[model samples]
Target: MSIFLIFALSKINYARTLIYIFHLATIPAIFAGAALTATSIGITGKVLAEIGKLSAKEGQIIIGAAVLDDILGIIVLAVVASLVKTGEVQISKVIYLVISSSAFVVGAILIGRFLSPFYVQLVNSMKTRGQLLLVSLIFAFILAYIAQVIQLEAILGSFAAGLVLAETEKRSELAEQVFPIADLFVPIFFVCVGAKTDLSVLNPAIPSNREGLVLAAFLIVVAILGKVVTGLAVFSKEKLNRLAIGVGMIPRGEVGLVFAGVGAASGALSPATDAAIIMMVISTTFIAPPLLRLVFKEPTGSPQSVSSEQ
Candidate 1:
């Protein structure tokens, strides 16, 4: 849907306007499309919890769908990154990337599942401080390095490592330790993203900047509509809050920033395009919490039920 919207706009006078006004190129436009497809599990999950719906059926479905969305988004990121690297799309290369990325994630999880018992035993035998954390980081980095060697994103490997570790007995303990590390690194990551983004393009005072603002608006609309429609795709006999499910998938949050950062660092995105993406990210992230609260509203005396079938 996003790709079609981008490409369709590119063929019209709007495309020419984008090129002349916003300096958006075909590749960056497509990159923007891919970026639009992301749903931030972090923000969405937090919002669901805040609204007292985190354990509800709608929340569970949204969480599961968001996880799948991130994985698929990562795969799309790999393919898009390759396009940025080579400067042209090769059907064969795309095919290889799609296959290799899917296989790598699946294989890593399967192999890691088998190895997790030994990993647990190894940690159990260790008397050193932070042994579990240290070993887990090592495992994650090893997979990350392997992913880099395979020409895929290191984050993909890290994600797969996380999936593997999540299945272990020490999952809760590991998460407790990992949170501090995530706290330390996640800010730095966002800092880098903010530093790389040229915010001047978003200013309305400058005539040239207006184009980017307009582009950002277009992207925001596409981003919201694209995910909102996913609710309709739910095929179920239960009377579920499909609107809540769709709204839950709205926030782009950190994941969207990663895409923007990658595009900026790769030099695929023009300054205007980069700014537009950043704006889209911020807008979606902020809007989702309130929108979610509104959509999940229940009657004062009624039970907080997510589905009639529940």
Candidate 2:
């Protein structure tokens, strides 16, 4: 993190002023939409439910943050495509991206917010076969394909599809059916991420070739801090512990893997960069469950906590 760099230099107590000035000037140089893309799927809500902790107060907060993080990512990625073709600065991109992102957001919002619910309601109103499962998969794939057509990630489309399913009256039935399928493929995504590493890149043997390392370090920081900041959105002055909620949302699961895979596919990521990215993903995922479990644990004799504790 350049933010951390400022602090690190502060510890040396030498010419910090110049460093801060340069840093301040350069921050405005970042690509806003690209910078805003989050680390990826936090332990999505279904994970918490399977662990039997969804009802806990803290679990609810974690799930809320994770959901918000996903929402922020969708908006960010939609905007990122617009900003890229026209490499404007962050401030300018903000305006252009908002307008660009709107159509995608509105379209998704219509499906997620209105159509999916109505469809589920209509389906529930029927006594037909359980082909709702097939219908949903078709919808997910169609949206995924559309996301690709728009120069966005298929995962983003899938997530939007997920949100629609989440809001539907068939949420329970749909979740029960789809989660088993997600469970099967999702871990493959993660394991593949771990598999793609070229350890030689992460090696410090060629310290002279430092550019890849620099980019890796910068991107990892963005990946973590961006999502963490968004996770804090789950709280206000009167509600959940914002820090805990944010921390719980820190783990980047399938989302990060998909990002790395995409970057590699795009030829934008080098071998060393891929290794570094995989390491970052592993760290976040390893830390998340334990941190969440700790923070979400309630004091003794609490029935709600007991019932929800995994």
lDDT of each: 0.80, 0.56
Model 1: per-residue lDDT, tens digit, 1-310? 4323432343243334445655677678667877777789988888777666889888998888777777777877776786788888688987898799889998998999899899999999999999999999999999889988898888888888888999999999999999998899988999989988889888999997887889999888767876677664566788888888888888999888988988888888988888898899999999998888778874322354333213
Highest lDDT: give the candidate number: 1
Query: Candidate 2 has what TM-score?
Result: 0.67
- Candidate 2, residue 176: how far the Cα is off, in Å: 1.8
> Model 2 segments beyond 4 Å from truth?
1-58, 78-98, 111-113, 121-130, 208-235, 293-310
Model 2 agreement with the true structure over 258-294: per-residue lDDT tens digits: 5556655544445765555566666667776666555
Cand. 1 Cα-lDDT:
0.80
Residue-level error in angstroms, candidate 1, position 85: 1.5
The CA lDDT at 238 in model 2 is 56
